[model samples]
Target chain A: MTAWRLIDSGILRAAEHFALNRALLEARRQGGPSTLRFLRFAPSALLGYHQSAEQELRLDACTELGIDIQRRISGGGAIFMDETQFGWELYLDRADLGTRDMSIIARRICEAAARAVSGFGIDARFRPRNDIEVGGRKISGTGGVFDGDALLYQGTLLVEFDVEKMLRILRVPAEKLSGKAIADARDRVASLAELLGFAPPLDEVKARLEQAFGAEFGVTFQPGTPSEGELELYRAALPEIDSPAWINLVGKPRSDLPILEAAKKFPGGLLRAALAFDRPGERIRQAWFTGDMFVNPRRTIADLEAALKNAAGADVAGIVRDFFSTRDCDMLTLTPDDFIMVVHQAMAQAGPERTRP
Target chain B: MTSIGDCLFPDELFYNVDTGIWARREADGTITVGMTSCACSMVGELVAYLPKKVGEHVERNKSLATVESGKWVGPVKAPVGGEIIAVNGAVAAKAAIINADPYGRGWVAKMKPANWDGEAAGLITGAGVRAAFEAKMKADGLSRC
Candidate 1:
């Protein structure tokens, strides 16, 4: 059986963690051995490599709360992380995963991670794109970055997530912070403490992940430390990754991303939708549904939001239609078209009025 | 235009199959670079694009531009060593253009090649484009675009 090195970094500042990300991925690209790393971070708000921190984060709130702002080497949306959550990362050649397709690689890793999370006696499954969830509530979010032939895939497990703090840190629509919105947020994000009534020991969680990954890759994980070469590379990378230039690498006007909202009264109840529209991309970056609308499964809105993320303007109808058709959502006196109309109205509020049927 | 399945490979362009990018030699000494249709299909609709600044020298196989789609970020590598002369403003303002029309208005960058004659010999074109990309797709386990 192939043997892989395992490194457990107790807790590091955001800059140090990002520096390690660059160092480890670069080392693996230069033919280093495959490694599995466990890491924790001090309170930090991380932006995806391509994100503009100003557009995605509440800088004032983050500053008041003493959260370090950093950008990840990987691609994904902004996230608020702290000691309450832990991270797992894998550095391996593309050949090690046996696939060059990003989606397949994501699935393989997420499924294995899901199995690890399920070991806690709660059902967890790999959601599409890159998330692991329990009963439609996200428990872990993942993303990755690749260089040459090597890649670094990482995910965070929320042991005791703070939904309120996260909502405050992220620049979500302000209305999303109300009691009802917070309750809705709680319904969509699951935590180990909430799921199992208590958080498991950190070592136990790490062991579960190690075992699951070993079984998936048919390899034995031998506990190890960062090689001297990797440490040297980390030292070299620190100056760049730790700099402000790296944090503000991608800057865009706030006008490009506008949060627009619309609401309408339906026979069943009032339906409301708030959309974060990317005007330049002409796509929906995110969507949130709230109101008195009655749906049997509470997660239907979250699922719909996931489906609509990054959706092109022209494809919204087809995507929403397909989403509703595939699932059994019981909406009393509320048709899927109603949901589509509200979203369209919200998006229309962004710029010059353009109507879609 | 030459095609393998639904992916278009213009017969006039030189391609680096490994990087899924194409280079078109213009009337001037400059070359225009862009991702092929297959590359766009592989990465869904692009949400963000960041190209190397003009006048910056880039080595062959190094990134000319970085693009993000579906939360996946990756580079569009240069097929030959060159100094970037210009980047597409249209793509910068609306990255989805890269997915909608990768060959025309969606071209990523224009570069003045430092060694076109030498590097051009390594790139595939004309009758060889289809087969080279087919082999790459097979090796990558990718289906027809």
Candidate 2:
């Protein structure tokens, strides 16, 4: 059996880390070995490949906090990455997964990653599309990129989290950065320290992941470093990845994505919906929920938000209906229609205005 | 028109069988490019399309545009490289239009080919289209579009 390779690229600047992302994925695309790599970034705000910096991040805040701003080779939402968290990625051929369906591939990889997180004695599970959550609160978020037959799937593990710090860096659609919002953010996201009562050692964390992935792929990992050829590619890619031009590849005006808000008090609690509406596309680019909601499992709101990102306006009701029907969740007395109605109220500016309930 | 399962391939348009994109040689000389129905099904629904600026020249098989769906983002390569002349504003406004109508209003970009007479040979069309896509679907482990 051919052995898989493993490499550790400890904390580096955002640009350097991304350059390695480019170099290694390129190597894998050109017939390099299937490998797993561990990485971390010194405080940075990274944008997904298709995102516009102006639309996703608060530039003034990122600049003031000495946070490096760059874009991922992969696509997803903008994220705040810092040394406090850890990252893991896998490079493999499609044959390894035995499927080419994008959503299925994502789900399978997340399931394995969830197993890795589960090894830490917390009940972590895969949430469809691309997230690993612990009881509805997200612990890891992932995305993928493919070049030829080689694909790279990567995700972040929140070892230590500061909701306020994240709120400062991101123009989150869910709610404005406020003391109450921070509390809600905590409800939706948590750190390894918060979940386990202490941060697990970095080596133990890596070993747990290695064991999970090794079992999933039915192969053992032999420690290795970037080949010289990969280093050369990394050097060449650094200049472009570190420049201003790369960051502006998908520039869009913030006005194009405006947050539309709606709130309602149900028997369960007051649930607020803040949708970052895409004006021209008539899509909800993202929806954030914040209010005195009393869902048994707090992660329901986060999962619902994930379900509705870039969702079509007309499909909101059906999507919510489908979501509730398929998922096992107890939102006190709140129903899916309550969620749909609030979203419709938020979309009033683009469509027929609904009277406040 | 020829179809493999639910994917439709018009006898008139040419395809880059490797990349799953189609190119149409417009009467006016510019080429219209878009994803095939099978390609659309593979990615589910498109949420965004960012095309290269009009007038920007691209090499053969290079990215003419970036498309995102299901949070998985990647490129739609040019079948025959040339300068982008126009892009579909409607599809940009609502990307699901591409899912709704892949061959018509969803045409991704219009390009002025650099050497259509030469590069056109690289694309498959006519009777060959069906076999090419059939092989592709099998290789991709896809049951249907």
Best by lDDT: 1
Per-residue C-alpha lDDT of model 2 across residues A1-357, encoded as one tens digit per residue: 569999999999888988988899889978888999999999999999888899999999999999899998887888999988999999998878877678888888899889999998999999877888897788998998776567889999999987898999988874467788888778778788899999999898899899999988899999999999999999999999999999888888887778889899989889889988887777887788878877756667888888898788888999999988988888889999999999998898654322211
TM-scores, chain A, per candidate: 0.96, 0.94
Could you tell me the lDDT of residue B126 within candidate 1? Answer: 96
How does chain B score by TM in each prediction? 0.96, 0.95
lDDT per residue as tens, model 1, A20-131: 9889888998999999999999999999888898899988889999999999988888999999898999998877876666787888999999999999999999987788
In angstroms, the error of model 1 at A72 is 0.7
- Candidate 2 chain A weakest ten by summed lDDT: A348-357
**Residue range with the least summed lDDT across 10 consecutive positions in model 2 chain B:** B136-145
Residue B136, candidate 1: C-alpha displacement in angstroms? 3.7
True contacts kept of each: 0.47, 0.59
Clashing pairs in 2: A136-A299, A174-A288
Top model number, DockQ:
2
